[model samples]
Target: MNNSPIHILLAEDEPSLAMIVKESLETRGLKISLFADGKSALQGFTKGNYDLVVLDVMMPEMNGFEVAQEIRAQDEEIPIMFLTAKSQTDDVLKGFHVGGNDYIKKPFSMEELIVRIHNLLNRKKLQQSSEQFRIGEFIFNFPQQRLIYKNNEPVKLTHREAHLLYHLWNNKNKVLDRSYILQKLWGSDDFFSGRSMDVFITKLRKKLNQDPTIEILNVRGYGYKLIIPST
Candidate 1:
């Protein structure tokens, strides 16, 4: 429970329904960005940071399933909910197959919709908390904000350091785009923040260098990659 408003990307072609959904969520202190079709919704998704997406299945230009697939290609972690008139078993399966976290049938009650939204977000929060990442010989306990190695004294990390490490750890062995990292963690990719990120990376390197098998490699003008030995 963070009291901050949850930003949602809502794509529903029906104007009246969209207005009602928007008003309902806004009254509950949630921020909603409404788009009339799937393509516009995809654009909003890319340009704006969102906690979750609510997609109407039948839409012009593209559909909810297509939009969810496109969103999954970018960030698989973001939660997606599908709203559809079809409640067929096949349709529900298809939604889950396309990376939907939750499915809500059309003509649903406002209370039910809000409850499902909260539940999906809460589930994601729980997953993030329980996630334990292995970094070479170290265990990154994200919830505890501690880096534990060989069951020895754990290295306590500052909030920023822990957040940064979580991102790097999640993208281990992959060249994480610098702008993506900055935008996700620091909310900006400006010159000052970029320099600041470098400083944190250097500090992280020093902290993690005790194990020769662990390495954080810089990908030239791209980003940083966390490398951990396979064995």
Candidate 2:
């Protein structure tokens, strides 16, 4: 059994369900932080570094959608799952719109929940691994959160910068829609996040500018493209 467990943030109101789920996950080597209200959940989230978040849609003080939006504002990469009783199409749409990566309806089986959790974690791991790519004169290690330039020292990157660079590198030489990047990297394509992405792009450009053959071009009225010239 692996001891260094995955930490999960579980926001659910029902005491009985919360305890059961917590015990179930704990038995499987997962750690959980349970909150009965959305407000408390949000507060806890701000203070904790969780691997994934499981949110109940009908929590007190704030609904799952609102809490998800708030969380997405701070973190764009953390996987979010919605555990709610509501099964309406609109509700499902809202869940994903607010940054939910998975949605589990109520009356779910423990086995299924565990499987879903594992699947999400596995996908995230794969993504991180695939994100480590070689750009001209630079080797980006996304998991390590650094860019190694031509046998020189590794330049540490912030979480946002690393994530953004990963996305750009993943779609290298192709035009990446601006809104798509904002949503994928920042969890939202709103005005504030868009502005923030622009700033990050500028920073990344400066960092990668050391290599004359590499350029991140802004696609007029559309998106950005990371161009790596073949030597």
Candidate 3:
């Protein structure tokens, strides 16, 4: 849609299908690099820069799940979408478990695929905008990964901690839905990632414990609320 091309990494073993998808997306102004195998896809991913990834689930040498996991291990925030013919719930769950941001079942319409990709990229942009947060006389600078107090004392935050806190502080005093948060931060709304988010929440609470006025409240089945007392 936009004249500015989005860099995309496409890992599909089927040449014809890959060509069709690549050409279709390219016509829409997306810049894509196609790989016929998962191994080559990952190798290219490691050596190149891409804004989004479309990985076929079944491939020789390596599978999409493994590749997604490896990518997540290095770049936690890159958007990843899985492409597979299988529509089984377990397979879909597995893709999300491996850090997939979204999944497209095979035989999908090109229109639908493009729409999903646009939505994912737009959502990522919105999240990035909310990375900076103001909370209880302190500013949480997510891009810098530091929390600065009024006195200018900066506290370094771990990757997960910074991301988790940024979301909470961005939605300060407002109820943030758990499912929305899990999907935005962890790239999935699965049980394990939910638990991991909980752990990060706890850690953030501890880190902010120094300022009793700043609190992270669990909304129980709903989500979390960050309470920043007004000075």
Candidate 4:
């Protein structure tokens, strides 16, 4: 996992700027996909896998805000960074309202962008580790990926699924950061992997649904929470 290269999706309309940013990030060994328009970027987002998304605010036919909204509908946890020349407070707030996690103004330095990306990724990684979790009548074995129910049946979990569950369970009563979960499970907070994680979470929810006391809650701007009924 540590050896895996981070994958990034860059949605910028300016061809020359996109190329420069893509090349700059690539030099750091990160995998980048460049899209010239919002439509193509959204389509690629649906079809391809990535770790993080870098979107330009002013784009043709479906601007970054619209694309972000669509992406959020499918995946509530992936990291989203907005890039735009608009510096007004209203514009920035609008980005956040549309589910943007971080914002970078246009004409920004490549070094600053790189640093911000690194910081966001690092922060995400720190939030995924959990000491233990109690789900319904089951106690999760984090390292082993097994759920031991009250009836003593041991439910096995896939590697990725287990990691996802661990993070949710660990954040039992709190908001679990979406970006952190993606980085922890898939090595990047990109669109595709984010969607994949959502699928895994749905499957996990179904498996645990048999226990009425267990529930996975979505916290809008934040992330997820695994609730355990009071004993």
lDDT of 3 by residue, 80-138 (tens): 99898876766776776677777777899998788879867875676576566677777
Residue-wise C-alpha lDDT for candidate 2, range 89-202, written one tens digit per residue:
667656766767767778999997888788668656855766567899999988767899988888876555776788788899999899987756544576655666777799
If both were scored by lDDT, which would come out higher, candidate 2 or candidate 4?
Answer: 2
Model 4's TM-score against the true structure:
0.57
Off by over 4 Å in 3: 1-4, 85-98, 127-131, 136-139, 144-168, 177-224
Candidate 1 per-residue lDDT over residues 3-93, each given as its tens digit = 7789999999999999999999999999999999999999999999999999999999999999999998887677788888986756765
Quote the lDDT for 180 in model 3.
95
Could you give candidate 4's per-residue lDDT for residues 211-230 as a string of tens digits?
88778887776678888776
Q: Pick by lDDT: which candidate is best?
A: 2
In model 3, the Cα lDDT at residue 53 comes to: 93
Model 2 alpha-carbon miss at residue 4, Å:
2.3
Model 4: which ten-residue window has the lowest total lDDT?
A: 123-132
- Please give the lDDT score at residue 113 for candidate 2: 86
Q: How close is every model to the real structure, measured as TM-score?
A: 0.57, 0.59, 0.65, 0.57
Please report the TM-score between candidate 3 and the true structure.
0.65
